[model samples]
Target: MHLVIGGAYQGKLEYAKEKFNIKDEDVFTCTESGDLPQGSKCLYRLELFTLSCVRRGIDPCGAFSDIGAWSGCVIICEDIFCGVVPLDPLAREWREATGRLLNKLSPEACSVTRIFCGIPQKLK
Candidate 1:
């Protein structure tokens, strides 16, 4: 599995697409109301999926494990835990949840890349 992370609007999705050679049709945009298509080669906006799971009273990490197990899957998520701590309780919770999910995925991922200014830096 591959995990790509960076700040919002940092070109993580484009980097993942180029790096993985995934076509548009094979990419899954993970959103609150959307479901992951079975055997999707790529998943983007996973931070929202995690937040949605939190709001729905579900364990986001556990829910993600199944998707993460897919061979050759590429996951793209924003690195939202940086900078000042959020004042809102729900915002704080979402930040923590995103961090935990990233931690859980990093070790298992065959490759992890951090993108900044359209540049890719391999982390693992």
Candidate 2:
């Protein structure tokens, strides 16, 4: 599976559709709400839901695992940083969350990949 990610308005979804020759229905948009740009298959608003759960200290591992299982084409958009930050607490937490989710779904057959717009940063 391919994970296409970008900031808001970066055109990642459009790029994916064009590059892969996939129709709007073939792509799944996982955003804040069930609503998405017209002509998209927004199955689940995972970002908002996950943020809500995480903020409340609720375990979202199961949700991430489920998404991994069900999604063959995913687009993770908004809120992802693309710079070499001077490491801070919030960044650390984000890294931890990303790591935990990846670990939980590591064995899944899908090919996990990330697409970012702009100059790539070394995420050491």
Best by lDDT: 1
For each candidate in the order shown, give its overall lDDT on alpha carbons: 0.85, 0.47
Q: Which residues of candidate 1, in runs, are more than 4 Å off?
A: none
lDDT of 1 at 26: 86
Supply candidate 1's per-residue lDDT for 48.
Answer: 88
Expressed as tens digits, the lDDT of each residue in 9-86 for candidate 1 is 999999888989999988889887545566779889998888887787677787666744566789999999777998
Q: Weakest 10 consecutive residues, lDDT, candidate 1? A: 62-71
Deviation (Å) of 68 in candidate 2: 7.0
How high is each candidate's TM-score? 0.92, 0.49
Off by over 4 Å in 2: 20-22, 25-46, 66-68, 77-95, 102-109, 116-124
- Tens-digit lDDT string for candidate 2 (1-124): 4444445565555655665577766655444223333333332223544454455565556555445444554434344444565377644555456446545544452443343564232221
